[model samples]
Target: MASSGFCSLGPTVTSLFSSHALARWRSSSISPPPLRISRALSAATTVPISSSFTWDDVIETGREEYTPHNSSDLTGFLEKVNRCNRASEKLAEFIPFVIEEQIVGYIHKGFTEYLREFHDIFTFSQNGSCPDRVDGFVTLNLMLEKPEDRTRAVADVIKILGDKGIIPGIRNELYPVKPSFNAPVFFSLERAAAPYFGIKGYGVHMNGYVERDGQKFLWIGKRSLSKSTYPGMLDHLVAGGLPHGISCGENLEKECEEEAGISKAIAYRAIAVGAVSYMDIDQYCFKRDVLFCYDLELPEDFVPKNQDGEVESFKLIPVAQVANVIRKTSFFKANCSLVIIDFLFRHGYLLISPTISLSKETSYLRLYIPDFNALTLKNLLVLDLVMMII
Candidate 1:
């Protein structure tokens, strides 16, 4: 939905990398040149260089045309799967519950069985349906008796699902159940069940990048092959879910320390950038998750040591090479690609051309920001421009 006006600026802006930086990047042999490099270096002579840059630069240097890469694969992965088939349509049978007219979570049609199985912890409409029929469509609701009882009820549900083998890879982690992102928590749910019930999940992703010899290098990790999800795939330096009762900052610091052995003081220096959201639906589950993104600049001498067994190894790769890996191979977790793309755009590595159609840009931006209902045409164009840059 990006505007044509903003999209037209693609060819006007100059290169984001200065001649000196480009020289170092090329010398490193991390990736091939994106465009034909002119021998002229006069344009870059007056540009100031600094390791400590601001987001204002991202906003300022927002015009350029970039050569395309294999980023289309990410677009295809995020396109909404057709649900017109009977099996997929069955997901519509569950109705979402609204509190203060905002969607909280869905109540499965079979929730009556749960009410009967755990009558002490659930309350259902006497008519077997909601009274209002619009705002109150859910047939069953969790009885919020006490703060402590909420965890107990979630435990019971986890036990029931475990016994039936309904949920996979239960991590024993707890996720808060709220009416909305800013709403008060009414109860808690097991991490695995959150997707099954279409609940919102939160997580954090920290990008560890460094400037060495005037070139940008990123620290990338390989997930352990034994991981239940995306095993052996590339991942950010430090990432983890926001568990129940923990703030985003706290969860990020914890993950930084645990996953990459970053000290608390160093981890606190990470800059909280923004968030990316997506809703993924498969045959048996639905996930509407959001990741809070952070960028941490590491010292040239710092070497990341994985304390958690989840990471197999770490590699220091140039930014362009990282972009190529994301574009050419399915080596990264699907969602991690979004985070990296965001970083690329924010840092001025990616730029979109005006020649590409709006539809193509829309498809690509959807991968990073799945829920684009509220995005304006200008915003969509900006994101599309960013993706096209990659």
Candidate 2:
């Protein structure tokens, strides 16, 4: 069995045959972030809702199916990846896994090809105390130009995903996104090893909610476009796994202060929320997550604020508004929007699943399949790679 159920790989998904990971682990000399006092105040302060990290997701709206490709970027990426040093822990850890082992073999081959092609442009290394890092690249969040970013982004994505499937979907809810096939997706990455496999990351993204009306409005923070990841866009309430310095709960409070600039009390309005994902990469890799969510019984006089400049505008959107955004294709990225929409519907926030019925499924998986067609798949491959790499 893998180390974390969240990871998607297994035994057949062998870590690169590099024995480098066998090296001894010097206790990470890096210092963790200091505990902040603001969290205590956040637990008590409750007013208007603020952004959250737990509420982002992957958008597979218009794709038809997953297809393989032979591209220069992918081959280049693999070639560089061919060299790396991981510790015993990582060597013994999990590697990317899929039901179809053949796909894995093909993907491995494709990426190696790209690595050789881009030999001069990129560098590959798998030197870590952990094993999965042997074949994986560090997750980085980059920004893009406006809607036309697709032209510029496509090339970058190919370099990241390689032969792996780089899924794409609608960015907005209005339905007809730029491609018209998918909704102009903004978030996607190379699929990772599942969670139970011991594969993890350092980004912050937790599952949380916003309280509005009598019901608990699912609240996710929108990422500032200035963010290295989804800059100038709206995303989950708490994002980028709380930066290692704080707990998931504390991170929520920080987001309130940073994203919406909500009062301290607003951060602590704890409600009965479900699984919370601590980082955006986690959300992107492992679909399910956990976090804190509660109705902030703040006086109606609550006015939200955002210090991070992420919230150019905030509104109390009904759970359905998320779907409308996807259907209308108005949202800039698909995963976070899809997450909010799926959470709402799955957790009974929507008319169908307004209250966690357990008989629901997120539309993201089904929706993205069609949009992932051949031509679109080709484009998606390019975009998805960029989604994974620089």
Candidate 3:
């Protein structure tokens, strides 16, 4: 049994993105004045989060466990979901980024100023040129018709932005630009610039579990401190961004080999378990991400080794303890929490009562596990599960 009292949670979860901070984000509108006049282009300023908590605090919170409660008691999972889907009301600050009559993404109004310099490559259609076009939309120049041309032209612009430090942390990786997961690729963009363009980014996150004596345990990895994003945070056993020209299965297999030393044979047995999508708007960057989730039942004796320098360490923790870590602490990387919560829900580790209210803004997790007969299809959609957290 787990502890009934959530000692470590305190103000950490509520204060992560407090309402007061959100008010400031709302007030700091970077929408340029409605004049055709020109202003000097500069890098967009980042939104400041007013929180005193640090990553070390998050780590410390993960180490502690509450006592005297049922092992299946889960009240704090909703907080994890809230962390992933944030600043959605700030969506008004962005404008539709259309390409070939298709709305491919959204660019922040503040970031749009930077693109105004490259008139040949970017077209700002604010005059309602087409009937379907929204007011004040951005699109690529029609002259660069071919995907190759658009890619090269955008690459040149990204280079300039990278040099100016407007778009920092260039990973040198290419992410396919499209309206949806299955949509035709418009072109390839630098991975770092995806959020700035508000493109729908996709990634694969796999939960590798071991079934030992009818009990289940999960393989969790601590990200290396040297990582550019979410360093020193917990992560999925095998996870990677879906770069251009690679299938989700291929990317997951590659990540499994590189991150966890899993062979192709073992990786091949991993099942596609569905996906979770979240939309977050932060300052000049709007992140609309969809993560495809997978589950792999690993042999109990199969230990994971980090072939790449990305993961700091790996641990085989019981799934229930892992849930407590997520429910009580902000230790897991924001998106990873969603995948893990989905796993818990599907496995019957967390009981779902019908009294909870589902929020529209929450990231919707879709489960595709065929044999799991716990929740009905309609219930899965609503996710109206009760929370025992308070």
Candidate 4:
């Protein structure tokens, strides 16, 4: 009886195995259906992807598709300023103010009342209802007899504005008064009103970077919450505006000490990479400024200590994360974004992809570097060399 039962079980097991094998063969013979291309993808093939980006993308217009709180504000401000400039017509209608042969500022016909009120401070070439624009400029003779006189004049202007409540208060910071971008300093002006007059300002920004385990990191500083402008905003490791009577190198060293507590020996190691320039205009002021950028590689053991109360804290962030912040957030000071973008380009982090347009790349390469015309041929050559080295 046992032998008969074993024989019956063997036949049942063999039948089940044959059915499973047949199912596996059928499954193996069937292939995955071809993937269907959607209409959207088919349309995408006709449009070429952009390979290049321009300075307008990141610097001028701010990044697209990620509108920060200030993006619209900046755009609106620029639009208003441009519209005001366009409404004014021929050169004769506008008052051209020259500094050492170049027209730096223009006073609109609307500001005639203010000009008349301050006529004592101005020396006109002719005396009449309307003075002829000399060489396309109605030069305002700021009868600055002495250096101290210029200071007093600037102070008096501030006082007049403050008395009328046009300006809230006077900031003690003094800015070098240049006729144009790189013209020699004619006098000093109050920092608060410098942009209001369309004066060109200079500043220095130091890029402090570290290498750890084959990755690059940047040393970023956060402005103190109590600071007046862009309070609590992110800043470069060391940055300061060029005050009157100080050279760029000297100002850089001083800022390194004051802002980051770096000794002169170490701070002087910073290499001048390049400069970034931009013109920002709003209802209140017009800012045409340039930042002299430097690259400094710090040792792994080195840490920054803020000597001035302006900085709240220091942080070491990876370069990738820093780029993300610039692209997605308005945490950084307006000009600081340009400096970081310059650093990324110099360090090869920002590259020209195959889809980027050649024209766009060329436009970015021609960054609005202020004072390029002011640079001597030799100096320009040297600058090109330094940029190549970067």
In TM-score terms, candidate 3 sits at: 0.77
Tens digit of per-residue lDDT, candidate 1, span 1-390: 321110110111111112242244334422222321101100001111122322232223222222235344333223211110113234455555443334556555565354357666554443424322432343234455564676686578767877788676888888987754555776678887787666777788989999988878889888887888777767899998888887777887889888899988888778655556555446545566767677899989889998879998787877766766554445566678678866775675554443433331122222222112332111211122222324
- Each prediction's TM-score against the native? 0.67, 0.37, 0.77, 0.65
Evaluated against the true structure, the overall lDDT of model 2 is: 0.31
**1-390, model 4: which lDDT tens digit per residue?**
001000100000111011233244334433322211100000001111121332233233332332222233222212222322221113233444444444455444444344456766654444333322433333444566565676677578667876776655468888876554445566677887775555667788889999999878899888887876767777899998888887667888899999998888888777665565544445445565766777788889889999989998888877766765565555667677667766765565543222221221111111322222333111321111011111
Q: Worst lDDT window (10 residues) for model 3?
A: 5-14
Error of 4 at 245 (Å): 0.6
TM-score of structure candidate 4: 0.65
lDDT of 2 by residue, 1-390 (tens): 101111111111111222242121112232223211000000011122222322223133212221122111222212111111112223223233211111111123233343344444333334442333445432112343343352234335453543454433212111111111122333222223222212222233333444556554334345564554444455555443322224445655676578666666655653322221211122123222222222233344455566766555554444344433333333434334433433533354332211221111110111111111221222211000010111
Error of 4 at 214 (Å): 1.4
Best by TM-score: 3
Number of colliding residue pairs in each model: 5, 133, 5, 5
Which residues of candidate 1, in runs, are more than 4 Å off? 1-93, 98-102, 107-136, 139-143, 353-390
Query: What C-alpha lDDT values do all the predictions have?
Result: 0.56, 0.31, 0.69, 0.54
Worst 10 residues of 1 by lDDT: 37-46
Error of 1 at 309 (Å): 1.1
For model 2, how big is the CA root-mean-square deviation? Answer: 20.6
